[model samples]
Target: MLSGMKVGKNFWNGAEWYLTSWRSADDPSPGPYRRALDTSGLPDNIVWEGDAKTYRAGPWNGRWFSGIPEVLTYTNVMEYEMVISPRETTYSYITKPGGPLTYIVLLDTGVVRRLVWDADARAWQTYFQGPRDVCDTYRKCGAFGLCDAGAASTSFCGCLRGFSPASPAAWDSRDTSGGCRRNVKLDCGGDGATTDGFLLLRAVKLPDAHNVSVDRSTTLEECRARCLANCSCLAYAAADIRDGDVRSGCAMWTDEIVDVRYVDHGQDLYLRLAKSELPPPSSPQAFPTAPVVGGSVAVVVVIVLVLVLIVIRRRRGSTISGKLQPCLSLLSFFFFFSSFQFLRLLITAAYANIHSTLDVPGARSCALSFPCIEHQLSPAHSVTSSSAPAPIVPYVDLLTLREATGYFSESNIIGRGGFGVVYEGRIPDGRKVAVKRIIQSPLLDEGGEAFMREVEVMSKLKHGNLVQLLSYCKDGNERILVYEYMKNKSLDLYIFGEDPKLRDLLNWERRLEIIRGVAKGVAYLHGLNEEVIHRDLKPSNILLDDNWKPKIADFGTAKLFVVDQTNPTLVQTAGYTAPEYITERYLTLKCDVYSFGVMLLEIVSGRKNRNTPTLLSDAWESWNQHRITELLDSAVAQPEPELLFELDRCVQIGLLCVQQSPNDRPTICAVVTMLNNSSSQIRAPKRLVFDAMTEPRLREADHSAKEGASSTSNGSHTIYLS
Candidate 1:
């Protein structure tokens, strides 16, 4: 199609216009592939091959197609328009005046391409193309399956979180048509509050909307409520994302979701799941003992039979009645003696094998040694171990960890802090991992209970924004943790480092996404059954994945604080510590909120808050003086005019979080709500004053007096004062 041409249908006249591909490169005959406009439920461009759908350009979502996020890059070269009315519907595009010529074409292979004339090159350059990758194939992953072209697995299809393959055999055979099924069935029949919750899947193309319910008048929260009220609703998403923080309009899906895949700059889809399946399951119960007991019994019986055979052979010649009684007595005596000795040997072997398998010292009890049965009975290994359950957290051997990290070479170190040092390593399975070796200190003690506590806490907590704890090691005096490696490292490198190029990469939209992600993570921590307070929340603790998604890290200083519990502890970083935590030694959920507030302002300004009055005072003054724009990082390009309001709102929220009194600051949950809902009113923040020199000097003196006190060169240091 040319730049100024239109292709669509006129309902009143019963006339239509579309494009068809040639039968061959040299032949002009119409082929099986055709490109046409589809207005069934939403306006979109679809490609068909012999009446079978092949590809779908996602529905028009205000600025661009929902699936084709690349359209934003081409806004300067051309403009697209889609019109829908009772009389007619059409789609067209026009190149900018005095710009190079541009046009689109459909190939016989069912691929679509847009070309632009290049004056210097003397040829047409391909500006964009569709059916771009494997993920673009129609229903590539089947129903409820998410397709990721960049996944490390050989197959590009995987079931969504909280779901399992409907047909495991089919999935193993590289067939994903069976899709997935919920791990825990939803409970929609509750009398009061429903037990169903939604899992948010971010940066994904919305599923096929042919059977969806679209209401442009309702807000996202209203959409969520409506979906929760109706049992048939399966998922929901925002119909539009044009506004900065106020995403209006609702799109609800009642049928099985299909054709969902990851895309750049995509929207979020919340899938309804049972509450029971939301949290990670507790560590698996101790290994079953039935297998061990049964194996030992079988061995004892075998020994008894062998002893009887030996006794019979030795007394074979004594057939007389007088000798028969003596032979029988000898057999009985041998059977009992052999059984006892064999049982002792079995237990000894079991103990040794268990220690080797688990890499734990002093595991002398036979009850926890079931894993050794397979090694003892090599012939019946498969039969003896088929029913055994896997351990939730596997124990890594010191030798394996040493090899992974090149014997703790200095070059392999990724980060170092008060707790320990983190090294980047690749395990035997060819998966990249971050290995943290705990520093030997008196605080952990010889029992290593502190290490276990950290592992237990991390194992139970599961969220997309939280760094996942893969496995751990506790051998002798060594304590280590393994985590999924993040390619982009931490937020501090980009926002507060010396590289201007990296700082500029974080545009306003990306920064907003990071802020929202961190907020959700903190809210999750506070909303847990036993609330958690991250005494140290800073830019250095927020790690970014390959996609730049933020994941909260460094849980060494985190603590589980139940409601009304006053477990006062002094463990915090310099700048991110709350006022009450520092002066009164009081730790609460609000303390984390305060730390988050400080980090939020630091993120916007791209500056560290290590100095007492620099960041907080500057932010407060900027808000009151109506110079919020001046607070933005100079490295970042100015945001669009439409985003200025959101930039100002972020500064106001930051101020509210840093109020002198903990009660005055909003809860982390409330902070998340404020960030998402632009309509929510924000109250003015209370004034906070810092005795600049007094606080810094006091902190330094306190550190010198305390034993085992160490700090990093950067002000982001952790202080552990008991």
Candidate 2:
């Protein structure tokens, strides 16, 4: 350990490393706040007020802690680790050798700072800090409350669903320390007959671990059953969310849950609640209850009045139709006249507006027509004029791109696909980038546009497991996308390479980390404002940074599903495509899930999911024969017990992901949650839909052409073994 480090603490020095308190400038004494490594379970950095954890740097998730996703970008500058053994467990980090001069300090106040020495300025510069905002404050919202930094309100604290502020007076006065209380109490009688369920809270930091029981052997479903059986368990979450599955077991709270808040890249927490407290399911019925009730009463009154009128008319021997005919005609005439005038007035206003615009002398060149042509002609300008795009990702001039990629030299080529060729490049600022130059063809305009749209989406997306889109160039027929270069390139070359040394690099832990990263990236894509489904999610599309951390890439073939639209096209890669997607042209988030599952199994076995005699069938057979160890990659020798358990659990999840029925498949979000929570239960998948990969027609075509299905005389579709 460096200076100022204790048996339970670690430190480093480089730049101006110092911590200041939120006190009078003259006060140099320490405050209540202290930063320390939490030794419980997987180690993480936490700032505590006495014994209570006030703020956390988040637990390590392979590459970095859950909350600090930016660490992925610093792979070239830093390395972090947590050591666990029978003797002791500790968390530590170090700057990459000869990379940067940096130091970290825990302030007397509450801030944790990482600083670097600025040689030119002869001063220390702040590199990073935790508790950077009010939302970072621990338990800013009391128990069962959520803190949203982006919420549109005067206060960030809000109660979780099925819950309300514990003290209305305190809440109103902005004193949320009382926290929140459930609206309905749990109905558990210890007989498993009670009406109780769980409420899932997404993107949240797990609550304090106090008074919580942790078990690493049960699945998530089993954990829920356990919590339900106890009757005192208030909440449950996965004990180890590293693999994103319930098989890792779980943690169940038996007392008041505290210090819970939402973070950008946080874990999921399933809070136990009474069934009655659950929010009502949503429906499409738009008619109001008040209108229905009032209409019914009016109809009844009208019926009674008509009956009396008819009786009087019959007694008088008079025709009621004749009497009402004149009145009805008068009302109809008045209504028609009003409607005619309204239509005429609307038409006149529109004509006047059009005429006025046309009268302008300069407007002849401009199309000032309805469904304005100007907006369509200058979309880039219009989009920017209305609302500025994020500056983080921008458009680059063609000249700059050409200089970066040596005018698309063959020597620079790094990756190739049907849509484009990716080349390694270095920008003017000495930062490395990958430039993808699209193949231009008049018949492939849609593909080009898709590439551009993907660039737009990728620019806005920020995640550790996603390839960052830095800029783009769309000059004339040349369309190009700039990305942050990954030194390790794609995963396929490493895992399926001829070199045994290369294959061995992906040990059990590394493979699990890759799976987790890919799951996270997929989950983020699925949860976007407009859900994006990467129809092609094969290993070649998964890239790795210098540290071998995986990043999901190649969105050129992605399908963006708007709120009301659906994907009707059949598209994917061979062996990795979902059966439902190919046969019925069925599309959903589950299609990508299936591909991810296939890739996951491949990663574990170090083999490709090829045609006919498939990896899928082989693994399934091995699983059924109770010899899954036979399917393990030979590179991983003499696996430890823990590694074997993780491998088995991952294999189970992969099978679950590749289920034949899309409905039976879990969503990508669920996959991420499952990967993190070891105790989450995974249901055994049904038998897979078998395909004949060696068919004559499939053999005639290339792998890329084998994605479609053929229609039979009976109107049913058959997979092309793609």
Candidate 3:
């Protein structure tokens, strides 16, 4: 909505806020790189390389953009506004009064950034930037193609419903730019005779709108009618997606749709397709066929005949009981036959359910419902495994990844761990990311598959406090995972490495924030439909972004399980492992709760739990002695008396998470509630005792190495069985 642009959404539904990069700092001429606020169906931030889109911030939800949850977390300092009226629709950013001066700029290199002035440092700190990871890249999978960060397939893209790639050879080569061609073309005749039906694509960024038309006066139903009336209209959607019942206004696309992607909190988009294009009905043979009908009639007739015979026997009244016996046998046989048919139907339904859960091509493996839609809908989730495909977690090309990392040059190396090495790299679009190349060996084939599956699981995960698995790479003999780069790196460097510069950066308030952030992340994971257990929850696995916001990373060893299900996988680090995990070879969400408690203690004491086994014990004793301040990290500035109470409460909660029995430990949900509500009271924990067997496992911890570590381990590690 800049003054000179003369652009307004009222006149042009496709009007957008464009940002052009200059050739140089002093040059005013536009460069090849540009960014735009796509205000078509829904507003999404997009960056472009010339005319080709390179990145997209998935659509604006009620609170924040669907793709960027971090901004929602830091909303206190900044506010985003989107105003739609009869004359204009505009999107703008506002900084809180007396807050840091911030600028949103599109760099010449095709990277879009949000920067804030830091007066203390006298530098502009990058608050946020994109394309953050491979998933953010626009048209990454091509037109009518779906890109899923959660896909397990080597390639990230897949054709949309009723479509196939236009060029299979190009797709096989991992080049999907040719997009897709319809398997069944629309049956909307020019005379208004149409047999085309709309397919619901849930949780998706609406396709490009250059060829779309808008009519704000119409309701969604009216919009549908209009599209149905016009044979040329390919699709239609509500122009404004708000949170109430009166979601009216219309936007229709008529030409080729491109750059469609699936994301959490995305808008529902309806794609027009012929009936033939739709998947065969779930109950293909629900209606009675001629044979079935005939058989059913025959069974009914036989039952009637048997009843008639029984009546005649009763009328005859000669040994009625004996005559009835024969009729009863016939009735029993008929009932059995009916029961058998019913059981067969039940078995068929079960098979269909399982098939829908896995092989079914849908927007999500599970059911999804939108507020705007009356019923749930499912489209192609992602291309995955042949047997049991989970949702797609897109894979990066090895050559592309190699170019990003400068062919694994030493200078690009940023981290080393049990998983592999992490390198800092920029994709072709100039977006910085972290690339993790899993160490390959003859012994790691199974491990690589496990890692890939775990990445798929993690890619489905989205939270402000959790590190995002944007995309991954699985070339022959190489496995690489691309993630949103954390500028501050792992938490261990600040807490355990005795780096005064790093340690001093975290004050009492910041430390508490980090602790709460991690707790929230763990709670989110635990709250998922299938609860996740972070088997290796330690300081090294916790990362900090530029804003000092903590994000939980490394899910390679994590376990996904349903509530009340029992898993006997003893996957954990030595010091943080719950006692039950080692002794009984049992695992549960409580195991993660215990690890979080240990991490909480470490963050507070600024020491490794292994080195200080008595940290929890000391905390418990100090809480009772009313001298908990003594347990706080001495290196950090002492908390004021008022803050000491909150610190004591946190320590008590930590103790609750690390109690002896699994049942004694608090659920992650309860921990989050406790952290959020300082006034809330917690139950007293049992007397603290460091597990006796924990110390002996320290050698194992050293051997496995930990995630987010900058060092490698010496020996092969044990794989936990789920």
Candidate 4:
């Protein structure tokens, strides 16, 4: 069918129209394959092979087909429209003016192809084709099965978390058609306090829409609660993702979820599972299994040794004050063991010290004498110094890090932050890396704890826009973190630095891209199973790669909020700190939103908010005065006429983010939608709490408050700005 053509049914006339394939290449008769619109529940395009279904284009989720997230990349070339009413239900698309001419055709093989006219090549070229991959086959992974075409495993199908193959024998032979069954039965018939929770599956296509319930009025949290209350509800997701971070509307599955697969830019699905199947809460203070096991073994060994000693003493006829002698012997044994351990540590330290002083290349002399002394130390010994769990990331040796960064040379330094100095380095394998060395302080233990916290936080997060933590080092008193290096440095360099060449590189388009990238990263953090609030979200913390793509960095101050945990340790930068955080000592995901808004404004204006004491007030004034154009960065050319509306919209969105009350601010999700879709309506932002007074005055008052009280009367933590 050509663009704008429709294949649907007319309810009033009871007439239906659909596309049918030819019998064969040479035959004109209708074939077995037919493409039709299925409106039984959610509307989807289905390719039927006579009596059986072969392929599905997934349901429409406002912006694009749930299974065709790639459509977002080509939105500029065409506009899709869907109509659902009593009269008819139809779907069509119109090519944009001056864009490629496109048409879709159903082949006798049951494959659908979207072809576009290539004027330069003077031939029709394939724009898209489906089933595009093995995963696109209808129910290829069966019910409740997830299909991942890019999975490293030989098999493309696997059961979801908390579930197992229903027919293990069949799956053993490479047949997963039977799908999977829940490992633990869900608690449904309880006193309304059932121990059932959700397992969040991120960036995945929503499941089949059949046997689904949707409510547009309810929020995602409400939907979750409602689904938890229903015995049959199996999964839930946001029906409409266009709303800001506080996503509204609900789509719940009451029956088997089918045709699920991973896709880039896809929506999140919350699959119900028994609480026992859910992952344990992540905590930096959690104890490691190795230490506990080692401790138990050590205790048994000590008890056995004491008993042996007591028997020997009794056999020797040393009966005078027997109990006191045994106690003294036990104490003496502990002292001797501790001294032996101390001596071993001292020897290892001395060898390491000698090794450092030597200039010998590829030396094994020290290793021959001390061979694996530190490595042989048990976890029990390590736990005596610190109870923190072992980090998930690999541990790099201190010597290796030293060689990578030129013995921690001053010439290799890349950047510095509150926690430590970052140095540019290349690993032995030729991979460039950024090494953050946390400077040792008198509070040595606190520094080590913070280092572990950052490592733990970054290890759990895996996203394109967040910097990747590759490894860490905890040799002696040194604590260092190694991350994937970003060549473009940080966003602050381009937007707020003194270099004109650097400032010119970030035009409105790049700034917009960076803004959107940061928003998506923050949204991902906030949407995590255990929501994370990036206590620090300034531009300096945002690093840019060669392509100028932004990656959120400096997660040392990030805080994970578990259930009922609202108060975060007060950590703030002067200008970006949210008013609610400063004045009321309250914190939430909204704090990051507020900081993002300030950064957004800074990107647009090319001026630091801290330097420009009235940046917020000025933006609000300029917006109201209809001179918002004046706020645009003068370092670059003015935005094109077409982009003027977007420029103004961003300014307005930023103002909305920095609203006086946290409740009034839009969620990061909403901010993303607003930034991406210019048509999305945005309410006027409330005036700033310090609209009458400049930032300097506010800072002065904050200083006074800090000196007056250590904490607020309501038991909330006091804010501390650096």
- Separate clash counts for every candidate: 0, 21, 9, 4
Indicate the residue-level lDDT of 371 in model 3: 14
lDDT of candidate 2? 0.64
Encode model 3's per-residue lDDT on 1-722: one tens digit a residue: 22113222454454445788888666879988877666666556777777777777665543455555446545666666666555465566666667667777777667676766668545555555565434456677777786654332245578877899999999999788788988987887768888877766655666766536876567888988888888888777776644344656787888877777655445557678888876455432121234444555666776777778778877888767785787778786876686567566656665554333233243333223211111132212222323564565677899998899999888999888655788999998889998988776443444456656667777777678878787887766777789999999999988887777778788776777888878877766776656666778888888899999999987543332112235444345678887766655577789889989988888888877778766777777776544677888887888854346457667878888999888888878777655653322355566676543454664456435543255643111111111
Q: How do all models score by TM-score?
A: 0.45, 0.45, 0.43, 0.45
Native-to-model Cα distance after best TM-score fit, residue 29 in candidate 2, in Å = 70
Model 2 spans with C-alpha error above 4 angstroms = 1-392, 446-452, 556-570, 691-722
Report the C-alpha lDDT of model 2 over 506-587, residue by residue, as the tens digit. 7777787788778877776776656667778988889999888898887643443222135455445677777765654567
The model with the greater TM-score, 3 or 4, is 4
Worst 10 residues of 1 by lDDT: 713-722
Candidate 4: C-alpha RMSD after superposition: 22.3
TM-score of 1: 0.45
Is 1 or 4 the stronger prediction by lDDT? 4
Ranking by lDDT: 4, 1, 3, 2
lDDT agreement with native, every candidate: 0.71, 0.64, 0.67, 0.72
Indicate the worst ten consecutive residues by lDDT in candidate 2: 713-722
| RMSD for each of the candidates | 23.9, 23.8, 20.2, 22.3
